[model samples]
Target chain A: MILEQTPDKSRKISWSYILLGISIVTIILFTLAPILWQVLTSVKTNEDISAIPNVYLPHKITLQHYLELFERRPFWLYIFNSALVSIVSTILCLLLGSPAAYALARMKLRGETIILVLIAVVTLFPYALLFLGVLEIIKNLGLGNNYLALIIPYTAINMPLTILVMRSFFRQLPQDLEDAAKIDGYKTISMLTAIILPMTLPALVTTGILTFIFAWNEYIFALTFITEETMKTVPVATAQLGGASLFDIPYGAIAAATILGTIPLVILVLIFQRRIVQGLTAGAVKG
Target chain B: MNNQRTGWILLFPALLLLFLIFLYPITRAFGLSLFTENLGTQLQPVFSGLANYQRMLGDGRFWQSMSNTAIFTIVSVALELVLGLSIALVLNQSFFGRGIVRTIAIIPWALPTSIMGLAWAWIFNDRFGVANDILQRLGLIETGINWLGEPGLAMVAIIIADVWKTTPFISIILLAGLQSISRDLYEAHKIDGAKPWQSFSQITLPLLMPQIMISLLFRFAQAFGIFDLVQVMTGGGPAGSTETVSIYIYSTVMRYLDFGYGAALVVATFMILITTVALVAWLFNRTKWA
Candidate 1:
């Protein structure tokens, strides 16, 4: 016998299997449809896209539109700006977020709850509602129409989650490790840099990836802050590019830009996906 | 205790950033809310006491936007949670090609909101859209639906778009929750001859409560603060049927240049969010503490 379970066990497995199968199929279709559509349309000409009977597959494939995005728009500049902003923002968020998270996690402060509440408050509200005031402050500080405005606010908004994540990761770590470092004569800063950080690589990577994605995909802040064309991030540039006019909305160019912009992130997600998923789902499943 | 100093020192940069960028703006916005004039004016915000609150109380648009927000948050968050949990439970099991499916599932969640908004807008287009094509092909409807053009259906369309984009997010989180549960618990349950539904109710749901709370909080926050999707999809149309509080505030600050009133609106949004977070945190604490 193949270790057949009792009727009840078999029935449970069957029901779960059925439900799982249905969900898998639903999720696969839902996730793939838009992506497939984006890829398919990227290769098709405008005429092919608007045809009465839609061409799901192109009879003739051409990379002309993707090629032309660079020819027409300052596509590469947007990519550079995005890269600079994302890299700088991610580094800053980690640098800033980790310490705050560590403090909130480890310290017994007088009003830690208040600080947590403060972080929560900032995260919950939309930046668009608060943009004008932020713009005012940015201008006053001589950071107007520059990348600093976006980077500062992006880091600020991301602080709470990053802090919470890093704090939780620090908290979950066995204290003995830190104690061991200390007993071995490692100073606090040295201990953190050498032992604690090295051990907390997974959490660090997770927070970094998530933060980069947020900064990379952020639109409203970049739109409101960086009005100068040269200062615009990828999403802002792509939106502006897409919204020029419905007639001139180069679907192929937009798709190409989207692909180019997101390809690195896609690869990053693929690489660290398990950790990212674990970190994200941490509060959801177990809490 | 020396370590505490290092912790504080380490935290100083973030604290400074928060104080300047987060605290100052919020405080200034709150202070501006108290004034009757724009912050841009030479005259600083003149103290108007509770007049801003008084004005907001009677403002029909404010109430209307709040109602719309309530509807949007409640309906969409609920649907996303249930669907997400169901899908998460399924995906949590051992299955062939599970890794590929899981990776692909995050595509919707990983998508830029603006792009998703644009894609969804095209999907819901009255004519030459994929959604209607599929629906018609399935014989679900005799005529094509004007998804974005109609009033009631516009909200539905926006919600559908939100659900499509965010349900995967909720699943990713909940699936994490499910993955954390020990398989031995299920083995024990099976040994006890518990049915699948029984195991789910007794084991999975209870174990997944924290994840559910987190998912609910994040989903509610996003939906309540939703702006870009509405901006791109309908531009708070057709006829302001989908005008959210964020949209209203954006117009006040950007379009009308009513910084005082816009600041007041921001204050109100902040209060609502704080209340929601506090309430949820309190509930979670109570459950855990008890």
Candidate 2:
């Protein structure tokens, strides 16, 4: 209504609407097209993808590329390794990170802020940098070519963020809840297990989901540490699509592998969509 | 009746695991940095002082990686922030299909980096890639450019891949921030005869600073430490143009069997990341308390 008095307001309104429209269209196309292209190419025969000025949609959909995917590599083994590592690491991180987070949140330590900051700092230390030291420790312990090597580091790197998230959620709980639980004669661990843990389910699920995804997608450490074919995780095996010796970089196969790799992650996101969004935003904004 | 002590006691298991598995290796990395070990013998870790740091300082390759990392982080993060904020604002509106669009938009971010690299690598293929195909069909180019093969274009390609996978991440965070802002504030601004731009600049942006900072922190850290995508896409190849610090460290320790030197590089990287993140945390805390 304020703009009604100003003639230029209509011009600006139209311009802004146009801008927003263009922006939306551009982002949708830029993001979705490449992904859709991957899917389309995956279903296309070799000749279709190789043809000049590729068709937007394949004339006939085929599962030949996907079939070739299984034929060319031990994808099942790689997926099994990925699942094993992701699940184990998620469990480990939650087990460690949750308690540490609770302690930091409730322990009344003199330098809780410093401890939290320390955890935050650790999140920035990527596995790439730490892989060297981790390798030596893993080798020294004779745990190479094992899932423990990947799971341990994944848990370690993810601990800080998990702790930060858990700590924040724990901080918001009323102290009286714990005091009342104690009044009811619940033991310390029992109180945590029965009362606090249930209250903090959302935080736990958030941390678990993020941890699982990170571990599931982890690559460099797995690549460097596990050379055995059976030990290779999804990311490592999928990355081999781009390796030098591969046959002309098999576009269809790579697309199929990419789709396969995205499936579990997409499923995780869909199932935990609400919790993930809630936890991610709340953790960041409040912290 | 002392619940706090018991809480700390309960924390011991987790703390011990962290100290043994996480803390030890980091400090060990620092210690390893001081040593030099030759591969041919049962070499003792002899102290080499700051020679490794000095070597990295003067190494052209390290500097190149550093520059590449800096460019990739700063530029892509800037774009992501801008795009993410706009998208978040749009999604914050009462529009149809918002949920569907938001969910679908997040697919790129949810997908793994290595997988994304594989997907984009196919898209960038000089021969059969969709990118070149689209460009040629649209008459944008006469011939397909070898996007990932060239030195200059390689960085751009990597940035494209990174942005595709991360803009949604930034948007999701910003959207969270956007949701926290009350409708009353915008209503108040409207009463004051504020334009949309004015409202955004004066109200939305200031309130969103914390979220923006966190987004920057997460994105910058991820970008700086990028390894899987570059490794999968480029492998620091075509004369090591796309090699990141992670790849460099990987090659040094695993490929060349120089554990001590590799450890030194890692320690250096850890120190830098910790220092930078600490500084940001401090700044945020100061602003918050002040």
Q: How many residue pairs clash in each candidate at the backbone level?
A: 4, 0
- Predicted structure with the largest TM-score when compared to the true one: 2
Q: Please give the lDDT score at residue A180 for candidate 2.
A: 97
lDDT tens digits, residues B197-229, model 2? Answer: 899999999999989998899887888888988
**CA lDDT, every model vs. true structure:** 0.78, 0.80
Please identify model 1 stretches exceeding 4 Å from their true place: A1-19, A104-121, A242-248, A282-287, B1-3, B38-47, B141-143, B283-290
What C-alpha lDDT, on a 0 to 100 scale, does residue A148 get in candidate 1? 87
Candidate 1: what lDDT? 0.78
Whose lDDT is greatest here?
A: 2
Give the clashing residue pairs of candidate 1, or none: A284-B211, A285-B177, A285-B211, A287-B210
Deviation from native of the Cα of residue B147 in model 1, angstroms: 2.2
Candidate 1 chain B lDDT trough over 10 residues, lowest sum: B37-46
Query: For model 1, what is the error of residue B260's alpha carbon versus the real structure, in angstroms, after optimal superposition?
Result: 0.4
